[model samples]
Target: MHNITNGPKVIGTKQTLRALNKGIVETIYVAKDAQKQITLRAQELAQSQDVPIVFIDSMEELAKACHVEVKTATAALIKN
Candidate 1:
């Protein structure tokens, strides 16, 4: 999605979770095939924070969409 480009973003699950927990994420992008254990908490946090979550087909697709060199399980676009 266009939102993934040219914005304050966190790539990978850990950073995404940290940003989500801190209430700084406006939206999160989760790989559709990501591990439930990893993405589940983040999804819950995002829902609680009223942030939107978008799902890509795969981790590789997510990373490619973000133009990153490595696969990313999740990512967040920061608030404000």
Candidate 2:
């Protein structure tokens, strides 16, 4: 998504889950290549909250989308 690179965002599963619990995440991006255990809880929480999810091909790609240097299992765009 074009919005991910510049929008206010949080990267990695822990941070994403925190934002989701706080009700501030607009959308979540998950890397399919990541271990399921690493991403499962966040995905379930986002679904329960009705947040949209966009799947990325890999952790590296997700990092790139989030404009981060290190790979991440997930990232989220914070609600404006």
Candidate 3:
């Protein structure tokens, strides 16, 4: 969470999935409280690509880490 706050990242499940598919994500952060359907695809794709997945406690927590105003189900730190 601390690291993601200052690094290049993509927010939300869709954006994270897109980055993961493109092999640009180094690590993905998923909120444990988010709906499985909303986050499962990203998790699976990250695993397939060997990108690390870190689970935050909730969407609100993840949003704070990303410095976003709205709740986000997932986010990713992109490779530099």
The prediction achieving the highest TM-score against the true structure is 3
Best by lDDT: 2
lDDT of 2 by residue, 18-79 (tens): 99999999999999999999999999999999999999999999999888899999999999
Q: Compute each candidate's TM-score over C-alphas.
A: 0.92, 0.96, 0.97
Which regions of candidate 2 are displaced past 4 Å?
A: none
Q: Indicate the worst ten consecutive residues by lDDT in candidate 3.
A: 1-10
Give the lDDT of residue 30 in candidate 2: 95
Candidate 3 per-residue lDDT, tens place, 1-80, comes to 36789999999988998898889999999999999999999999999998889999999999999999999999999999
Residues 8-71, candidate 1, lDDT per residue (tens digit)?
8999989998888788898999999888998999999999888989989999988987889898
* Candidate 3: clashing residue pairs, number: 0
RMSD of 2: 0.8
Clashes of 2: 0
Between candidates 1 and 2, the TM-score winner? 2
- Kindly indicate the candidate among 2 and 3 with the higher TM-score: 3
Q: Comparing 1 and 2 by lDDT, which wins?
A: 2
Candidate 1 vs candidate 3, lDDT winner: 3
